[model samples]
Target: MLTYLFMGIALLAIGFAVHVLKWNILIAYYNTKPKEKKNNKNTESYRKILGYYGYITGGIFFLLAFLEFQGISVPPTPVTAVFIVWTMIVMYYAQKDDEDEK
Candidate 1:
């Protein structure tokens, strides 16, 4: 059950990445609002950054799900910690990039 949930999240993240990669407007680092879609700056860089992170996050979730499905003891703390750190790091860089262009 838990594994299924994780897999679902994994698929969603990967799908988001793919969509952003192809459309460059589906999801972005900062300009997510419909009104701001047409004014997204540094779109190429932001798209790549977001897509790569999404792929990485999806891969992490998929791995965790696989390990759990295989009867491996997967601790929630470690995964949660990693996700927190990852999100903070990504956000920092994304913000920096956004600010640098402004």
Candidate 2:
């Protein structure tokens, strides 16, 4: 129960930081790049997508925590699946080459 709550809060914080504050420090692959090569102008759209992902997943975690508090038992498998699928979608959008810009 507490685990879900913590995860939900953390995700929400990360989402707020990334989406509202425009902090890219928490992004995965993008964070590892050199500062001079970040080229954030070209990646704003993808970052927004990632931020949305965080918001959604965080909401799910919050809902799960609430449900658990209500004495409802939910399996973790479905949440795992959701995370995997959403992550794949976000990564695809983030890493896809921008042929139109060429």
Candidate 3:
């Protein structure tokens, strides 16, 4: 369980880094497939949402892992609920901002 938690954290961290750095490796790989070009506004919005989600979820998982390691058990139900609510709030604001920009 601990190993899985760590693995998830690592994956989230990598995803966050990839978004922040705009690493071309993944972009190049994705571009290999023929797809219609997306407008800059849509691309930015997608990146913003992805970056926020990765950062928030990664932090939550790290906190849970740390607490578990320290023998402090948190009820999974409440934590999961809070995470969902928080993610919804974030998405709401992100979408709101996009709407305002338009």
Candidate 4:
């Protein structure tokens, strides 16, 4: 029972993060204007890339949760922890890119 509840919550958080990131990307893409006659000039590719990385990271976290829910032994969390940090560093660079463009 508790496992199910925890898994449900983890999945929900992951889903919500992915959904919000994608929505932001779509909204930014559609509602913006060309810069100097180039679509790439002012585009927020950083945010889009972050969205993708976020999806992958969140999915892995949710996978761990699912394994727990299914009564399967989850591997040690070190790899996942490293992956999370890796994603975070990429996200930091993405943010830097966004800032540099501004």
TM-score of 1: 0.69
Q: TM-score rank, highest first?
A: 2, 1, 3, 4
Q: List the global CA lDDT of all models.
A: 0.67, 0.79, 0.62, 0.55
Tens-place lDDT per residue, model 4, 11-99, is 45544554554344333333454555235543446445645565665566667667777888766567557876886787577557656
Best by lDDT: 2
lDDT of 3 by residue, 1-102 (tens): 374377458648765765787642443323442355333354555465656677767776877888888888877788768777976786677557655765
In terms of TM-score, how similar is model 3 to the real structure?
0.64
Compare the candidates by TM-score and give the number of the best one.
Answer: 2
* Ten-residue stretch with the least lDDT total in model 4: 21-30
lDDT for position 52 in model 2: 87
Cα lDDT of model 1 by residue, 1-102, tens digit: 376466548655655754464565454444454565546656666666666777677777877777778898788888778888987898788678877876
TM-score of each: 0.69, 0.80, 0.64, 0.46
Candidate 3 lDDT for residue 52: 62
Q: Per-residue error at 61 for model 3, in Å? A: 1.0
From the highest lDDT down, the ranking of the candidates is 2, 1, 3, 4
User: Model 4 misses residue 63 by how many Å?
Assistant: 1.0
What lDDT is reached at residue 61 by model 4?
A: 62
lDDT pick, better of 1 and 2: 2
Separate clash counts for every candidate: 0, 0, 0, 0
Candidate 2, 10-101: lDDT as tens digits = 88888888888988778777777667658857567656877887898899899999999999998888877977898797777676743344
